[model samples]
Target: MPRRCATRNDLMKPGYVYIMTNKNNTTLYVGVTSDLERRVKEHKSKKDPKSFTARYNLNKLVYHEAHQMIGDAIAREKQLKAGNRAKKMALIESINPEWQDLIIGDE
Candidate 1:
């Protein structure tokens, strides 16, 4: 057997399931994106001012997970969205106890 090195192209394309919250963590938004950095930037910039996220000021990225498949990411997003506030909070706290913004420097 021979050792093999991983190449950029050989790596699986990643999709992201992310949670964004308001300044006070009063609101939460779960979403999936192939490009988490760009999506988070859009949210922060209020790209769609009329959108619910913009209206709710849900621009603070609190938590995120990466998936090898987009379908899995979408499914996770759906699951998170369908969950109650307590469940979502638990998920965030598990990885980000302080609910810190995760999108920083992601761009």
Candidate 2:
């Protein structure tokens, strides 16, 4: 049987798309995860020393958005990643003027 492509409605797992940055807000990382809190914790703990987030110390959750389906979150993450740094910064600033960590007191 031929494989079938998955439709948007087929991807129903809830997920979150988040933007993380370093303390100085000089770097930005976009990620999509089924478990936002757990993922953030992993980043904070430097679960993968060689990972981009860990290498850049981008553990601060500057922005995040939730979707009804994981696929949507993944798509959003890709779009954010493909965009320019100025666009990303503008998006972050729209919600976080000071670029403050959205997930505070977790450390």
Report the number of the highest-lDDT candidate: 2
Alpha-carbon shift of residue 9 in model 2 (angstroms): 10
For model 2, state the Cα shift of residue 7 in Å.
12
Clashes (candidate 1): 0
For every candidate, C-alpha RMSD to the true structure in Å: 8.8, 4.5
Q: Write the per-residue lDDT of candidate 1 for residues 1-107, one digit (tens) a residue.
A: 69676455534557899999999999988998879999999999898999989999998999999999777787788988889999999999999999999878532
Instruction: Provide backbone clash counts, one per model.
Output: 0, 0
Candidate 1 global lDDT: 0.87
Q: How high is each candidate's TM-score?
A: 0.84, 0.87
The positional error of residue 103 in candidate 1, measured at the CA in angstroms, is 1.7
